[model samples]
Target: MTSRDTDATTDATTDAAAREHATATTAATGPAATAADAPVTISYEEIDGARIAVVSLNRPAKLNGLTMAMLRGLDDAAATLRRDRDLRGVIFAGAGNSFCAGLDFGSVLKKPMDIVKAFAPNPLAGDGANLFQRVCWEWRRLPAPVIAVVHGHCYGGGVQLALGADFRVTAADARWSVLEAKWGLIPDMSGARTLADHVGAEQARWLTMTGRELSGAEAVEVGLATETTESLDDAHSRARETLRELMGRSPDQLAATKSLFNHAWRSPRATFRAERFEQAKLLLSENAARARTAAMKKTPPNFVRRGTWAFGAKKK
Candidate 1:
């Protein structure tokens, strides 16, 4: 729920580290690392940054599918981010060929019924946050901005996961999809909440319900992605180039601007006030359960037409 502040050191050192790691941030090398010192399981990378802490989700075999273990790691990473000064941002990326494939197939299969169950009146519980939201929310909650570099397949939970980051740079050919419906699931990993944060509700539903495929290029159009690069190498380069722009800003000025924009989607204040209610309706609807259940069977789910609001209805 809380993260510690990182220690201060020569900006030159942190800058060099950030450049070297490419995907990692400069916060890792600071005294804030004390929080990260905890004994941990699972493979992860921590890069110290003067203004950011870069965290990498390491299980390439599953395409970085999140597991309970990975969740715990994320918790630790968030904890390490608790209050302190000096650090200005956080960055996240996945290890290996893919950014994240979403939740592992076995994890989803274990509680096939959860998707149909009514979401509690509150999605945020014990931690005052939900794991699904934490996937992207944790990154958003930081006092700083979170930058994500996505490549390869960014689908379902994976895309939702990236939704948490403030900015994202992806690969040109990366394959993306909402896909939860295809697997009899919903974008519980914070996708539902954050989907409209960038893209609007209608677009979000069409993607979630139908589970159509998307390319990295389309992602930019849909607002799920920021820009596309030819490869990971280029993606990182652009990230650094963007970072250079960030580095020029006064830390205080940048922080304030980020904070203002971070909560720009505040419920009462967000423009989707009307759609938010409808979305909540669907989240708890029986129709959602039936639709999700069918998709899990690998059945082809019906979706609304791209420009039309019709779901499964005959072409007009």
Candidate 2:
């Protein structure tokens, strides 16, 4: 064959392979989204020498409603963040006015089998969380803190998504609700864990059963939010301020702190044991010694980078 003919054949083969791969991936997950059509977008930057990941729900005309594509995009972003040890924090936001309205019931309701597939349990995941659950749960277990900047509507699945963050800063006029009850369902995502922890069991049950709307201020009062601002810019400012304060701490301590507090929600025996175990692990680290020296000298400590540390079976 002529060289030109050979190149044309090769190009055709590559195009066919790409199309096949895209089709398979879409079938396994859901719809495909290109940069122009994506429901979610993730970006990162270094702020004050700290790496911060930013995740945005980009379907604004529909108020950033949750779709399989958006969920998968978010899950993929969370997975990426989990592996980045240099990441100091994450800011979860939505493009345009709202963070997220809720599930796009219009699309999801038409795909019963797809819903089942999304929830298929995984044996390797100790908690039995499927794809739907991991999108939220992963944020909770992320090595760095996640701060959600909320504005406008945050209902149902949106509420669950925000709950996954360590701190949620919402605009005072933003709407918040536990809306599944209104749709004849329940908050089946990891919202249950976050709600039970943030608000006590009684309040969690009441809110879930009622599905009533709460203003951002009321959300803070009810323990569903960390703080409320006058506007979206204010929310971002608050998150940035919090991130700056957090950047001063050692990553090991931050991870250990999150783990220790998370353990607090468990049995007393487990909590105590985890406390001792985490302390022991941290105590043996060279970073801990550096921290001590820095404290004595009143200077910033140059501890070991986060991903470099390994502690027994805990090193995932």
Candidate 3:
């Protein structure tokens, strides 16, 4: 064949392959496979010389509804943050008006096999967490503290996501709900586990069964939120301020405390044992010495970079 003919054929082949790949992706993920549906975004900001990670859900037009891609994005973000020893804190937020309106069932239900894959446990990690659960649970496992800033609609999986954080600061007027009941479903996204840590069994049952919406103030009253602010900006500011305060302390202690509460809270013996173990390590660390020297000299503590310490076995 002529060189021009060969070039033309190659171009056509590439075009056909592109079309086939696009068609396959669309079929697998449904119509939600658009540029606008670009799941989650992660960025780092150096605040007061401490590196803080911010994870934002990018689907604002649909109220940041959760999709399979978004779930994987969240999991990936958590994994990335876990590896960063310099990370002091993390903030989870929504890009637009709402935090998240729960799972995008219409988009996800299109692929039954994807749902099955998401529901299956991770064989290698031995954590007993499926993809849906890991997206939330991984936040609890990170050495750095996580705070969820809730503003608009936070329902179903969104609520679970916030619960996974060490703290949740919400806009006073934001709507919060355990909305799984509304869809004739239960929260399978680790909400069942985290919710118990915050509230009483009766209260947990009421919220899960009724799926009643609560204002930010009400959420705080019922133990769903750490605190509420008058506006979205205020909520974020409060979260940042809290992180700044946390930055003043030793990162190792903060990590140890999180692990203690998350893993050993329900067992007094375990809590005591963990406290002693973690305290022994912290007391002998350089950061603790810096804290002591700074306190004695009445100067700010200049701590060394944090160490990644694994305290407990992975929990579901």
Candidate 4:
């Protein structure tokens, strides 16, 4: 056979495989899977000279149910925000009525290869996080504080996503659940780590095993949510207020505080060392000096942008 003919045959074989995969995926996932085409929206809201990023899950018709594509979009959004030194905070919200209904199994299962890829650990990531874990844990890695404004249904993966944030401001009427138990699965999307920070072992076990739903008020009582508001609007406002309060402080100090708590919690020796190390760094920082001057003058601090820090730094 001629070289050109052989090349054409190879191209035909590749095209046939592509078509087969697409057909199988469509048949398995149905037409609703097309909803994954909607992108997660990332917009910047400038509040008091600080850049606040708002990441809205866009599949409203599905109650912001997570599909493989949506998961990828969320990870990409977090990565983009991580590089922004000027970012003061991030607000995670859902479009339409609900916050998130959790993972859309039908959509994700259709692309079986995607699931395997998401489950595998990323070699370059020091945290040993896979794609699914990164969708939640990446928020914790960001220097800026992250607040999840929850309303409507937040279940399974959705709840895990909220747990990853520094704070969760939930609407009084919102429904929160572990949800994976219903499907005979455990909360594997970094929920095991973050949930422990908020609630005790027994409570976490009960929530995971029973898949019981919690009202926003109950979530706070159990330490799942940072606070509950009368309404979704109130929750958003509360989150903004919290952001403003945090933004008033030195950015480096805030970053240090987050790192200290995240890494040093539950260990006396680690916590003490972290406190001293972070204090040393902050005491010498330009923002710290600005903070001192502003406090003495009773005026707002004009601090410089945040500096780079070693993320997930190990304790000595």
Residue range 73-171, candidate 4, lDDT tens digits: 888788888899888998888766677788877677688888898899999988899988999989988889999989888888889999989999999
Between which residue pairs do clashes occur in model 2? none
- State the lDDT at 123 in candidate 1: 44
Among residues 3 or more apart in sequence or in different chains, the pairs in candidate 3 whose N, CA or C atoms overlap within 3 Å are none
lDDT of 1 at 55: 70
Best by lDDT: 4
- Ten-residue region with minimum lDDT total, candidate 3: 1-10
The clash numbers for all candidates, in the given order, read 21, 0, 0, 0
Q: Write the per-residue lDDT of candidate 1 for residues 1-316, one digit (tens) a residue.
A: 1111112111111112224554322233222343233111222233223445567666555566765556656756766764534555555776666777766656544665453332222444543555545646676666555678888767776788788887988888887788777766677766766788778899998888887878888889998888988887788667756765664443433444544565556665563554454455445443354456556786643322112222443532
Identify the runs in model 4 with alpha carbons over 4 angstroms from their true place. Answer: 1-37, 265-269, 308-316
- Assess every candidate by TM-score: 0.65, 0.85, 0.83, 0.83
lDDT of model 3 at position 185: 78
Where does model 3 exceed 4 Å of error? 1-37, 308-316
Models ranked on TM-score: 2, 3, 4, 1
> What's the CA RMSD for each of the models?
18.3, 11.8, 12.7, 12.8
Error of 1 at 41 (Å): 10
Which ranges of candidate 1 are over 4 A from the true structure?
1-51, 107-127, 267-316
Computed on alpha carbons, the lDDT of every model, listed in order, comes to 0.59, 0.75, 0.76, 0.77
- Which whole-number lDDT from 0 to 100 does residue 167 have in model 4? 97
Q: Between 2 and 3, whose lDDT is larger?
A: 3
Q: Rank the candidates by lDDT, best first.
A: 4, 3, 2, 1
